[model samples]
Target: MGTLKNQVQLIGHVGQEPQVTVLENGKKVAKISLATNENYRDSKGEKQTNTDWHQLVAWGKIASLIEEYVFTGKEIAVQGKLTSRSYEDKEGVKRYVTEVIVSEILFLGGNGK
Candidate 1:
């Protein structure tokens, strides 16, 4: 079988303030959580809701834009691919995390001021 591809696209609200950091090589990285909610009626005729949160990572120019304009509750659309990495925690236990590596980002709604 052919190798599988990993890609993701999401339009949602920022869950918290974006965290920006600059690397030694002068590259910038921004990290944030995005929340997407769904509304519907349950089989019992009552309203139901679901919210999904995703980890988003932006680099370089995109990181700069996110650092400048993104904030909690702001809406945004992100196009990116999934990435996973392993790291050792404080106790030396290995841990794994998956995040979306942003290739494009679009701010939605009014400009943040």
Candidate 2:
């Protein structure tokens, strides 16, 4: 069989405000965090809730749109692929992170009033 692919689709609330960073080369990058939640009952018959956080990044024109339309607590649907990278921190320790590089995003409900 052919190799499988990696894909991600999520509809969640923005955890925090979107942050835009401009590189010296004039490239724009937008970073945002999203929160997804699940509600269920545990084996003990008690209510439980779990929340997961995801980091999202957009580039170029998408970055601009994200900066303009995205806000903390906004509901959005994002479709993208996963990307993971490792880098050295200022302390010279290796750190790893995974982010969803958003290829498309949609605003749900009405526009921010």
In model 1, the Cα lDDT at residue 43 comes to 93
Local accuracy of candidate 2 as per-residue lDDT tens digits, 1-113: 35457789999999988999999999999999999999999999999999999999999999999899989999999999999999999999999999999999999856875
What is the Å distance of residue 6 in model 1 from its true position?
A: 2.4
How displaced is residue 13 in candidate 1, in Å?
A: 0.5
Clashes of 1: 0
lDDT of each: 0.94, 0.93
Quote model 2's TM-score.
0.90
Query: Which pairs of residues have clashing backbones in candidate 2?
Result: none
